[model samples]
Target: MTRYVMVADLRRCVGCQTCTAACKHANATPPGVQWRRVLDMEIGEYPDVRRAFVPVGCMHCADPPCMEVCPSTATRQRDDGIVTIDYDLCIGCAYCAVACPYQARYKVETPRFAYGEAPTESEAQRHEAGRIGVSTKCTFCVDRIDSGVEQGLTPGEDPEATPACVNSCIAKALHFGDLDDPDSNVSQLLAENQHFRMHEELGTGPGFYYLWDRA
Candidate 1:
């Protein structure tokens, strides 16, 4: 079976949050909820310390902790190791959210909607609820991937054509591809660079890797 993975170069990430913005726009998340968030942290002594921005989203782990603890089996791993929530099946219990080692799951209030026109309270409420009554988050733009497949380009080859984050990345720090393909950039990046997964001790076996190091 073929599997795909996502990898990122932390060194190249500028923390501009183009990924975050693109995700919000694509997913149409209301103001309070964020499917993709760039977490910033500052550590060490002021003179010698550094600041880092780590973009947080579904890690799509092989041994997903969220899956193990889900009571309703709302969360499941995809064939390619992508983790997703079944909106119709989700009971809004937030058990999966509590179980995720990466804290990736979100249990937010169903937000109101807003169309391109100016927002009234009722219109805003309806428009905001794009997909109501479910655990919500990034699907790694699976819809986009499917769409790209309809076109000529392979999933990872079409940056703008596949994922919103990839399209928004001015630095091209984030990469998406089939990990099984040795020729793919995602695979080559992993082989060539020293990458680290966040919260590795938890044993979630995240598919995503970050390249943050001293060169």
Candidate 2:
């Protein structure tokens, strides 16, 4: 079984929103529906303060609460551990939104454009008609992953198969790979780093891991 995960190295993250921009451009998510975002965190006090830029998005948990609460059965987790939303089945009741501890889900009721009323050709091209009035979140670039794999490419290692955010990471803070593979990049990093997952107590088994230490 294949399991995809993302590892974020805090040391290399410079709080640059390049990943966020790349996500927006690639997904063409509506205004205020950020599938991927970097949270600027400041720790300690005054002179001893430390800044950390943590990227946050759909963790694609092993135990997905969103999928559980979806009354319409719109949310489902793929065999590869990618969580996806079926827009046709979704009722946009926001049940998944309320159930999510990560706050990864979004309900876009109205459409908005970059230039107010009229949308540009590029915006229109990227827009998904199926996403409107539906619960939306990150898909871990599943389309790219599937296509890449079919073409004999490794998703987490290949730039074309990886998530846009990971590919756009200027500092190489983000890493995507198969956690199930012992020799995978993500597995090696997790094995060597002092890492933690957000809200693990909730038992989400979030695929996203944060590495605070180099060794």
Candidate 3:
């Protein structure tokens, strides 16, 4: 079984928010929702303060809490390890949202556009009709990944098949690949770096990793 994962190289991130922009553009999310974001953390004392950017979103946990708490069975984890929400099945009870510690799940009862209440031509093109009153979050660009695989293209290595956030990362801080493959870039990167996954104590077995102070 192939497990997909993502890695963020903390040393390389510049907090440019390119990944955020790319994700919004790709998913066409409304104004208040951000599928991906870079959090700025300040370290050290005030005078010696230094900043670090931590990119966060859905972790795609091996033991997804959202899936466990979904009353409608709307949340599912694919064989490839991508966690997705079935909009049609979701009742927007927000149980999954409450269960998710990452705060990745979102529900919107009303439609919203970037500029105004009325959706623009471009906004309407990508707007998901069934998304209203349903849970939504990142899909790890599964459509792109699946399509790329069908076309015999390597996802992590090929820009076309990779996640928009990864492709838009100017600092090359983001990496996506099959963690089950030892030879994959993500696997090799993890093996050679000092990395840590968020909230490991929760026993969620998150697939997202943060690499810093490389070995």
Candidate 4:
């Protein structure tokens, strides 16, 4: 029972948004669609104000409301705890989008380019026709994980198997690994840090963890 999870260290995040750019480049998402994004927050009063950059996306929860509400059954969770969307089976009703508490889901009705009318060569080449009008979100780069595993690589330890966002973090604030493994990187981080998951009271059991302070 491998449960994949990501941890974001708030103390280290510098709000650079390199992870956001890497996600867009890797997924080739439309102009307005962002699968990975960092939220900037001003904490405390004006005199004691401090900025925090929180990276957010699909939590790939232990109990996903999006999965329960998908009429077309396009949203599916893998045995390894990776949530995936079958574009071929997706009907694009936006049901799953509404059910997602993390606001990670995106449904684009038409092709959109970075430019006004014309798509650059890279955008055109990477554009996914099947993704149009479908509920799409982060899969923690499952393709890379699966492919790397097939090639005898450890996901979190190997750069080739890790998620693009974690690899691209300029501040090294993001981490990904199997939560079920006590020896994993994420597990160790959680054990040594004071952390919280967003909206945990909703009972979504989100896999994304935010480390705020040392334990």
Candidate 5:
């Protein structure tokens, strides 16, 4: 009953977007398809206005609408709360993308590179052929988690097991851990802070949490 989750501290985030760059490099996502992004939000009136850099991506909900709407059954959720897409089974119908409320899904119809028509050596080496012409989203670096577990390491505590975005946060704003474990980092964060989830009213049961204030 290990439920994985991420917690982002709004107070600590500086909108540097290091997490975004780390995600791009780790996942080798094509241009215009950002699996992880920070939304620069402005709150309050003119004199009291302030900016909030909210890091967001796939929520990996307990009840994912994308999974329910997938006609091909390409989208699936693991027991640990990670949502993944099977490119081979996907038909590129974009049904899951349409059903997603967070707009975290992307459908790249053709192969594109950062440098025009040609891909750089690094891009070519890391390019995933299966990702083309299919819906793609963040997996929270499940491979790292799985491998780390096999090696007797604790995810979220171990850099090799943690999500790249969480590990790359310069401000230490992002956190990942098991929500089901009360002693886990994410669980402690939620218990000690005033936090909220995006679109929680929809009842998707998103695993991503935002800490707005100390409790």
Candidate 6:
């Protein structure tokens, strides 16, 4: 029952977006396909305004709604407690996406960017050939994890093996490790913080938790 958890210290986060870049590079994600997204929420009146940035991806819920509602049975919980989906089984129905409280899934027929300069036809042809027909999301680097675990690399190891997000955090605000181990960093953080999981009222029982800044 070795389950890994991701812990973010909001108090330490400076919104550098290094994690976002790491995720993108590690996952080879295309435009409009982000496994990690930074959302900014504004609070207070215009005169006394303040902002908060929340980086969100898949919560990888314990009782994943996506798993429950996928008509094709494309999504399910792995033995390691990660939720996974089979794109070849998905029919672009968006059922699982709708079922996810976090809106964690998306289908893609063509992947392209809307921002910055567009890719050249040669680059488009190359990427499209690699991933023109597939469903995508934050796998938490499932392929990488599988490969890394085989080679004995931990989730926080960087440069050559750790997950993209964990390695790329400029502020070092993110931690990932076995939640089942009391001695693990993730476990230690949870013990010290008044942590909260997103949409806990939704009852998805997400494995992911957040250590928030004092409001």
Write down the lDDT of every candidate, Cα atoms only. 0.76, 0.92, 0.92, 0.93, 0.94, 0.74
lDDT tens per residue, model 5, 1-215: 89999999999999999999999989999999889999999999999999999999999999999999999999999999999999999999999998889999999988899989988999889888898889999999999999998998888999999999999999999999999999998898999999999999999999999999999
Q: Residues 17-133, candidate 1: write the lDDT tens digits.
A: 899999877877766667778888787996989888777788888898888887888788878777787777788888777777767767666544445446666545446443566
All predictions: root-mean-square deviation over Cα? 3.1, 1.0, 1.0, 0.8, 0.8, 2.9
Please give, for residues 1-215, the per-residue lDDT of candidate 3 as tens digits: 78999999999999999999999999889888988989999999979998999999999999999999999999999998999988888999999989988998888889999887899999988888798999999899989999999999887999888999999999999999999999999999999999999889999999999998776
Better of 2 and 5 by lDDT: 5
**Deviation from native of the Cα of residue 171 in model 6, angstroms:** 0.5
In angstroms, how far off is 57's CA in candidate 5?
0.4
Candidate 2 residue-wise lDDT, 3-106, digit = tens: 99999998899988999999988888978889999999999999999888999999999999999988998999999999999999998999999999988988
User: Model 1 scores what on Cα lDDT?
Assistant: 0.76
Q: Estimate, for each residue in 119-202, the C-alpha lDDT of model 4 and write its tens digit.
A: 899988998899998889998999999999999987888989999999999888999999999999999999999999999999
Better of 3 and 4 by TM-score: 4
Candidate 3, residue 8: Cα displacement in angstroms equals 0.3
**How well does candidate 4 score on lDDT at residue 80?**
89
Estimate, for each residue in 89-159, the C-alpha lDDT of model 6 and write its tens digit.
76667777788888767666765754546765554544543345545578777777788877877654443
Report how far residue 94 has shifted in candidate 4, in Å: 0.7
Q: Please provide TM-scores, in order, for all candidate models, with all chains considered together.
A: 0.88, 0.97, 0.97, 0.98, 0.98, 0.86
Regions of candidate 3 where Cα sits further than 4 Å from its true position: none
Please tell me which model should have the higher lDDT, number 4 or number 5: 5
Off by over 4 Å in 4: none
Model 4 has a clash total of 0
What lDDT would candidate 6 get against the real structure? 0.74
Residue 68, model 5, lDDT? 98
Model 2 stretches astray by more than 4 angstroms = none
lDDT of 2: 0.92
